[model samples]
Target: MKAADFASASPSAIRAMIGRGEWTGPTPGMAKGHVQANLVILPRDWAYDFLVFAQRNPKPCPILDITEPGDSEPSIVAPGADLRIDLPRYRIWRDGELVEEPTEITSHWRDDLVGFLLGCSFSFEGALLEASVPVRHIECGCNVPMYRTDIACRPAGRLSGPMVVSMRPIPASLVTRAVLATGRFPAVHGAPVHIGDPALIGIEDIARPDFGDAVPINEGDVPVFWACGVTPQAALMASRPPFAITHAPGHMFICDPKDSDYAVF
Candidate 1:
């Protein structure tokens, strides 16, 4: 299917494509009005600590849906959806080291694992498009650019790391409109954290992103950064949890809720 078709597809259609291994790329514009999420799975023993970490850092780690230990289905956000295979890609970590990037994790699935679905910035892009704000990556039909920042998240138990952010080059004229459109949905990443120089956030080179593909910053465009759901993977890297799983950067898990479900207005 053409990439443009994803923008109008239903969440289940998107998820079906993912589950069947047909659509395994960045999910930026897929199922346009539905919510997308960041995935973090941990053992039951470490679930509470990560939960605390999410609470301490709501902007980057807003919780959307979490599954009980041993459950692959996230009943609250997408009933009948399988976390083990619904996402386009996953990061598998062992002893805090990234071991593999897999399309499906059914082979690695364990009964004691708990799934945490964090709100993704993609959830707010529909609002931005509706408000006439340009989401460049989507326009270019590529993955959103993401980077790790020097900013530290409050340490909670065994989890702590620098916040990661997704960058969008907004037309300078619509920067406020972009912010205002997103700020209404705190459940997803809300507003911009950094607006100008990437260097301020320790991003030395905007062209070379740590994760996802870099899109062009057109003339008169300003780089805008939003706290990202991938922040937890940064924590997993730092804290070195024995076993953890996360969604690959820019490849999010599509949820059942509409963008309006999380919007303030």
Candidate 2:
């Protein structure tokens, strides 16, 4: 299905589809208007360090909600929801290496695990759309291109790595509009970190993204990058804690909060 089509679907509808195994992929355009989140599941022992890391690096890891150890229900974002079964897909890590892609991690669930929900770009994308700014990847029906950058997030304990960002190619005329619109949503990664020159942010090839699919960049378009929630996943791998889990790329946890709920102004 095209990314834009999912924009109008209710969060529960989208989650139902994901829960039933009907859909499994990136969620850029899905459940538009509702907040989408980055998931970070870690052992209780390591969660404090990760939480502190998020506190120190708010741009990349805006904490939306944190579930008690072994409790999958995300009360604030999606009441009565099971974190392990709600997201369409999940990535399992062991000693920092991605070892498995599981549709459901019920077997992996442990009482000592903590669930973290982080702000996602999708929340701000709604703002961009409202202002008549085009998000190219959605228009092109693909995942937003993401990359690892040389910009280092402040380290907390073992969690440290270069920031990761998602890019949207905007026409020169609309660049400022896009930036200003997104800037209003600080909880969801406000403002452009790098306006152009992917090389400036350490992205070598626009066509070969570190994560997500590459979309077309028109001749007059400039690539705009935003701090992404995925930065934590990159940080997690670098820290290489004994075990961790995260929502698969493009498969975010849909939330009850509207885009306006996270707006800065």
Quote each prediction's TM-score: 0.88, 0.90
Q: Top model by lDDT, which number?
A: 1
Q: Each model's C-alpha lDDT?
A: 0.88, 0.88
Across residues 107-174, which tens digit of lDDT does each residue of candidate 1 receive? 99999999999887767888898898988997887878999899898899988889999999999999
Provide the lowest-lDDT 10-residue window in model 1. 1-10
Write down the TM-score for model 1: 0.88
* Candidate closest to the true structure, highest TM-score: 2
Q: Model 2, 1-265: lDDT tens per residue? A: 7656888888887887778888877676677678888899999999999999999988888999999988999999888788988898899999989999999899999999999999988788878889999988878777788888999899998788899999999999999999899989878889988999998878889889998899999999999999988898788888789999999877789998898988868
Model 2's number of clashes is 2
The alpha-carbon lDDT assigned to residue 49 of candidate 2 equals 92
